[model samples]
Target: MIQKLQKKLEGKLPGIESWKRMAVKSGKGESIESESLQKYSDWISKDKLNDMRKAAVLIGLFKKNDEWCFSLIRRPMNEKNHPGQIALPGGAREKNENLMNTALREAFEEVGIKPEDVQIIGQLTPIPVPVSEYLIYPFVGVIDYEPEWVINEDEVEELFILRMSELISSDNGYTETWDLRGNKVEVPIFKVMNETVWGATAAVLSELIDIAK
Candidate 1:
């Protein structure tokens, strides 16, 4: 089944235009189950969104022991925003680079995966992150071999290897309540490697899974 799914994914991925349409139709916060629904409600306001900082993340895929997998990083607790959160390999965009370059550069810096090794496939919806005041662009890519990750200990607390089969399984999704901004709210997340993945990271993955369908 995994091999079959992999073949299907390799056939034809949606292009940039499809990504744009998907971004608008992604249902924003309402699509992905999260505690911070209010912030995403205003995601469609182009004027306000344009004022926010820009960032990018890479959803990289590779094969391991005949199974498709991806990588996620746990941010160090001392970071200013989204401390100790589970995230894709990415960061804020630099002044001289495009979104794809930002994603590739950040992934290399954080995980030590060489930029040349990654084949840029496409991208998912661009989502606005209110807490960080940045509009994050999510790009999808694939590598032919497993990476020998050299994690930057200062920025990354730990590395997570998540399998595509687990992500697409019905049992992986769950709802849990957490105290956020003085309010106890219910957040939908994917349970992977005994960790809770929520917020923007989960939102992007949720859209990617939808696109795969």
Candidate 2:
């Protein structure tokens, strides 16, 4: 099953080259061969990570009827952060909230996903987005039945119910170009239906696809 998923989700979750290396060292502990440990080590290698903060996101996976689907949203055009970009249900870590709670809170705030409806399967290693100063802990969860979703317009421009089957499709999973720094850089991007899922969302998806598909 893992092999089938890995094959099916190949380019679907791109740019996990580093993560693939981490998984090769599965020593079975909190600090096994995983992105969490690697990112922490990478963080130490850099001098700026100490000034960073924590964040959390719910990698909420569910089924619409019998078809598997995941929630996505385009941020409002007016937001100061990663605005107008496609992303998962998550946000900044508040002063007193844990990562799990932050995921739950952000889900509700961004969309209308009820906290109790999600059954958390487990957590993925925290991925550090150094440029954003956010160390994102991506938690994977499942909802038994797809709930009718609504978008909070103040934060979400559009609420998308993307079928996982389509996402895992061989051709749709590919990379694209980005104008970063002073050069035209290429980044791993996922194309599903009419939307493009990339950046941090794609990065987290890369780990999840590597782990469980």
User: lDDT at 182 for candidate 1?
Assistant: 65
RMSD per model, one decimal? 5.8, 8.3
Worst 10 residues of 1 by lDDT: 18-27
lDDT of 1 by residue, 1-213 (tens): 334434544555442223221221121333322323434445444356567789999988889988878899999999998999999999999997898999999999999878899987777767777678788998888889999999999888999889887887833447666666665555667788889887778777776776665
Model 2 Cα lDDT, one tens digit per residue, 1-213: 324543444434333463442232222223122555456676666965546798888867776767767788888888876878888888888987877989988997888788898876667666666457687877767777776776788888988887766765723346555565554545556776688776667767666655554
In candidate 2, which residue pairs get closer than 3 Å at backbone N, Cα or C atoms, i.e. clash? none
| Top TM-score prediction, candidate number | 1
Maximum-lDDT candidate: 1
Residues forming the 10-long window of minimal summed lDDT in candidate 2:
22-31
lDDT against the true structure, per candidate, is 0.74, 0.68
